[model samples]
Target: MPASPSPLSSPPPSPITPNLGLVCITVGPEVRFRTITRTRYLSFPEEERAGVLHALYGDNIGRLAGAAAYCVAQGIRLYRMSAALFPMLDLEGDPTGQRVLESLSAELRAAGDAFTAAGIRVLVHPDQFIVLNSENPDVVRRAVYALSFYGLIMDMLGFSRSPWNTILLHGGKGGRAGELAAIIPTLPDAVRSRLCLENDERAFGPTELLPVCREVGVPLIFDAHHHVVREKLSSQDDPSVRHFVLAARATWTPPQWQVVHLSSGIDGPQDRRHTDLITAFPAAYHDVPWIEVEAKGKELALSDLKQRLKPTP
Candidate 1:
């Protein structure tokens, strides 16, 4: 009988590769950059509003295109768009806003096309000021407006207002999951369709927010650092870590990469503040495709984490 083939005859298993990316901006390579909004333009003469709006939107769109190009070249497939990209959108429904959107439609479509061709995924996270569950009606309205603005941006990017280019928000106003649940149906379909809820340091954790996400038919973005601080789950091997990680992933539909935000703590009263670089990654995060580093160093931090994750020669 022929000798059994040696185990070494088989090719070594391929190394585990991660699909990783940075948040809104990039550094070092310095491809992604920002544009000034010039809110003061809104104060200019009404007759000049059209010109001002066009200029602002045009400049920002150019910068956005640059950002997309950077992602394509760097193999960074995920990007979180900045909330400030369209300052005029804050004045939603203004004739000027409509003009700006109309004027930039082609450019926006081109940028979106480039992104799609490069296989880059886009996401938007509204600022903390947006709180859907706030008791104040005005606050809630503003929050909804912000979501609408983000929805419009995605629409302009030639993207369907769907979870593919999702809009992420944090759970706010602790224990008010009922309020959020009630408000979800009332939001414009444009906003609700792309919206996702995330756990924050003060208000919600995976355990508390998961049910709300499921009830609203949205996905949850598990912030590992926030969960560790809020739940005090310090160990990387904590059973809860894997449990919640899997739970968050379950909220997303197939073909959508489960997104998680990563950050480290600094010296502070709470020690929960985000540091410039991630010093360590929780082992429980294994197999996660898209991890957005929320460190102050942005892309620099992501580079550091990628270096750490590389297999030793």
Candidate 2:
């Protein structure tokens, strides 16, 4: 035999070389974030909400601890907590409601502190109900009051709304954007710096949402699934999706990270449902720092993204 090739002729080149260009990493699944949104988890069976949280997050403290632990273990830089918990007042009539709010605020503060200490940022998203209800002046007053107390714990405030609501644009063409700008000023400077707007499943994609965000001086959370839904609903092609992403990029400023949502879609007779499936978008245009997978099988979806995103040195 000609000289046998050395078993390790060329030891694998160093595998840890860093890519000079932007890099995208999948943080984890989005449904995991929804653990706090008991109501949205399922519209019916009101009683199951607590059970679900218990099962997923263990008790409230357990949930916060679990979230903190997850971020630390996975090297995830950011995590989102559902706004459902923020609207603790919804349970106020009950005798325990006040205690619950205090506990929740404490938990949030602890969790936020833990995350920050671990070098991760926690972003809390507001529910659609809050914004729609905020349109009422009375509700606005109450929301502002409640936020004044609990807002201290969060690093970023996310607002996700339905398309119809955006169409109305509460104040003008830039509905929630305008509302956020007006209301954010009322928030303590600490909270205002953390505000962010998310794109919903409705017709309004980043293209429509970015203008409003720019006017208000906040960043945008581009939910990939929402863009997919908009593309399918509007019958647009790949170019449309690319356009939307580019538009969002234009609005982003430095030091204010970009958070994007990723998931799959199930095509039904009339519409497509956002499923937890990961796909590739050329890395040439966008380098997302955080991606939340909005799928039913959250962990499984996360694993899939990991495999797909493995470093290729």
Candidate 3:
């Protein structure tokens, strides 16, 4: 966000070093998109429901595949798909969105082929409410079910079950690691195989999450900006930052290149909000293969970061 306050940021070298990424949505050339709230979606008459869903659901699937073609045109190789790609899929009632997804099997396969053939790496992050560490059983159950649905989406896209096609989630803001640890293995294979935990700015930091990630057998993504805000660190090069980064990296293995996140603060170090462009990166990200650029500028931010990170002769 804005400009960096004199941090020693590293340049990216392809494959061995970080490949900058974009979050959901893009601007400049807007993609036609639609999403409905759970309340509004549930209000449709039973007779009108199927038709409404067919149009709405098919529109998103086309857009999802269309994004890959856009990336190929723009020379972008990394993308995180929209988290709500299949709306209301986790509902407990009859219209759980499964039939629609299955009905659109050919479209899903075509979308999968589009990404794979183009070599655009794909991943997803569940919405914030999908928390596993909640004290409420209902919330936890819903979270588990939601995660399974994410895995299903990845499968529909024909993505391999690996952290490379990760279903990322936060460890919750409550700081209840014990409660979260107890439920990791109970998750279905579709989820557990692709799952990754991230440290948010408020409660979970790499220090708080590393042990649990290690214990639960999942990788932890180092969010460089969040760690700076959470710990009130002066720079990204702090030795402790690298120490924890390596510790988190150790939990990951081959096939899934270790992932990290980079961003500058919206105002300064005190703000959790992301700004239009990222201004600095961390030396600790030296070996991270995937660096999701978390910024409000979307593809603009990602492209700018990559240009600045390019090594100059």
Candidate 4:
């Protein structure tokens, strides 16, 4: 395990230190990893679901645990873990997940311990298909199941039910923020405690999600690139964003880590598409605790941003 941070002597985060975050994989020589796809997973015979899921889930766990170690070594403090960690672990047809988790309890416990022990904050973003606010009853039901699964996994991995170990999801169906907020209390403690909402490129921006965030008592992760495109800003550093940043900060529980997603654009004029590397970071983020550098470059982009952010001697 990497070194753990000391107990806070003052306010939870006295210094304006935003730890750089890497999304999913490591690009350079240090590490790289992946998980089984649903299509490939289902291709296997139904009779083999037990062994197959064990292998796939086990492999994913191993990869994540390894990535945690890599983060500690690289001094990267935040990581957005892939949402596909468990595949059919939540499916009603496939109930072998509990057994698989039991079988790998030792590995799971150790990996979870390592992540916490390393003092590395871990989070996950479910795919776009999951819209907790969707009016479609079936869609909402499935979204609830998927989210509950994330909470369960976090618990199994020994993650704290706090914003630091978040299960991030976009606030889709933007206009119906109330419906989203109404569902929060009904959710199990696992999902309720760790769930966070983020502003998306078009549907939900800071203006749309802020009220829901406060109402639901969840943190709001301001995605800089998304906000730039959503609001037609000159750049992510637009002065206007400072207001949004401070407002978003107020939504978070405080001092744990106010997360923001950082990415560059592929097209000019604040395109919603992500590029290989980010051009700049919001000065407003300096006081935040985590900025997830989610670009095509992955960890490489994160490393580049860190280098550029380093103060001159």
The prediction achieving the highest lDDT against the true structure is: 3
What is the total number of backbone clashes in candidate 4?
A: 0
Model 2, total clashes: 4
**Which candidate, 3 or 4, has the higher lDDT?**
3
TM-score of each: 0.88, 0.63, 0.92, 0.90
Q: Write down the lDDT of every candidate, Cα atoms only.
A: 0.75, 0.47, 0.79, 0.78
Candidate 1 C-alpha lDDT tens digits along 197-219? 89887888888899898888888
Stretches of candidate 3 off by over 4 Å are: 1-17, 30-32
Query: lDDT tens string, model 4, 1-313?
Result: 1122222112122255468888887666555555566687778887887888888778878888888889898898788887877777777677777678778988988888888898888898888888887989999898888788888888888999898798888888978888988987788899889988889887888888898888878989888778888888887668767788888888877745688777767666377677677666666666766788877777767766666665544
Off by over 4 Å in 1: 1-16, 28-39, 235-237, 268-270
lDDT pick, better of 1 and 4: 4
lDDT of 2 by residue, 263-305 (tens): 5444521244644343333232244444555554444555555
Q: Write the per-residue lDDT of candidate 3 for residues 93-181, one digit (tens) a residue.
A: 76547887889978988987898998888889988999888888889888888888888888888998888788998888466988888
Clashes of each: 0, 4, 0, 0
Could you tell me which 10 consecutive residues in candidate 4 have the lowest summed lDDT? 1-10
Q: Which has the better lDDT: candidate 1, or candidate 3? A: 3
Q: Which ten contiguous residues of candidate 1 have the minimum total lDDT?
A: 2-11
